[model samples]
Target: MRFFLEFLEFLENMQLMLIINTIMKMPTVTKIIYRLKDEGLLDTRICDNDNRVTQVSLTEQGWTMVEKINEIASLLLTDSFTGLKPNDIKKLNEYLKILKANLQ
Candidate 1:
């Protein structure tokens, strides 16, 4: 499954409960958030207006890691497709489309 954390780049911060309820429904999301916070990738603080709410934001290290992950993903994708000709890519695209249709 695609991770909700993948879209964290777009938001400044998010509430713990909102992240669990709105973005990820699984109970393990709480564990993941706690793990990220413990690893120092995410910083969590009690909300100013509401002490009950915990706000989570990426730390400097987290942002750096995210950038690196994106860079690596891009490089891996480019390397994987490097030797393919135009027709090869077109045929691969057709196969991907059929695969997607079947999945759907």
Candidate 2:
């Protein structure tokens, strides 16, 4: 889950270690990365300036998947709030923003 979200956050190529640090588990992150590469949704290469550093980026297919995932997430949120009033939704949005800011 963290891996997917990080991929969305960093759409361009990013250093492999940076991603691992964000997710906070090298073995698990490495496994997921290998699986994504096997699925042809991600690409990785060694950085030219630093042989010890590897870079990762999403493939075209991964971008398409991200779009679909976002669409589904939006639809799910709308459906979940179907019975809520407009003002209630607005309040909920405001509260969520506050909570997110606090987290940051």
Candidate 3:
């Protein structure tokens, strides 16, 4: 249960960072804006010239929380991949790639 929660945190934290960085750089996405606001991870402001447009920026508390979650996830990842032969590791990676492709 703890591991599952950690994994969830890992996904959420990565997603938060991706959204934050993407919003900082390129074209804005509605999903990112909704997610950030829904999660209370960031704030948004609408431009007057483009009322449909939103600008997103992370809050300090959000950054701190995501950072801690990322740290915990990193620790869990390091600890979880403890025992595996070389062939097993290769097979695992291959299977994961296949699974990801299938999902896409």
CA lDDT of each prediction against the hidden true structure: 0.74, 0.75, 0.60
Give the winner by TM-score: 2 or 3: 2
List candidate 1 stretches off by more than 4 Å.
1-5, 13-23, 49-52
In candidate 2, residue 40 scores what lDDT? 82
Q: Indicate whether candidate 2 or candidate 3 has the larger lDDT.
A: 2
Scanning candidate 3 in windows of ten residues, the lowest lDDT window is 1-10
* TM-score of each predicted structure versus truth: 0.71, 0.71, 0.54
Expressed as tens digits, the lDDT of each residue in 28-87 for candidate 2 is 777777888898877888889988776778788877777777788889988999999999
Candidate 3: where is the Cα deviation over 4 Å? 1-40, 85-87, 101-104
Model 3: per-residue Cα lDDT over 1-104, one tens digit each? 23322333444434443544543543344554566567776676775687755545556656666677779878997777778777988999999999999999
lDDT of 1 at 52: 74
On residues 10-29, what C-alpha lDDT tens digit does candidate 1 reach at each position? Answer: 66554446645775665676
In the predicted model 2, the residue pairs found to clash are: none
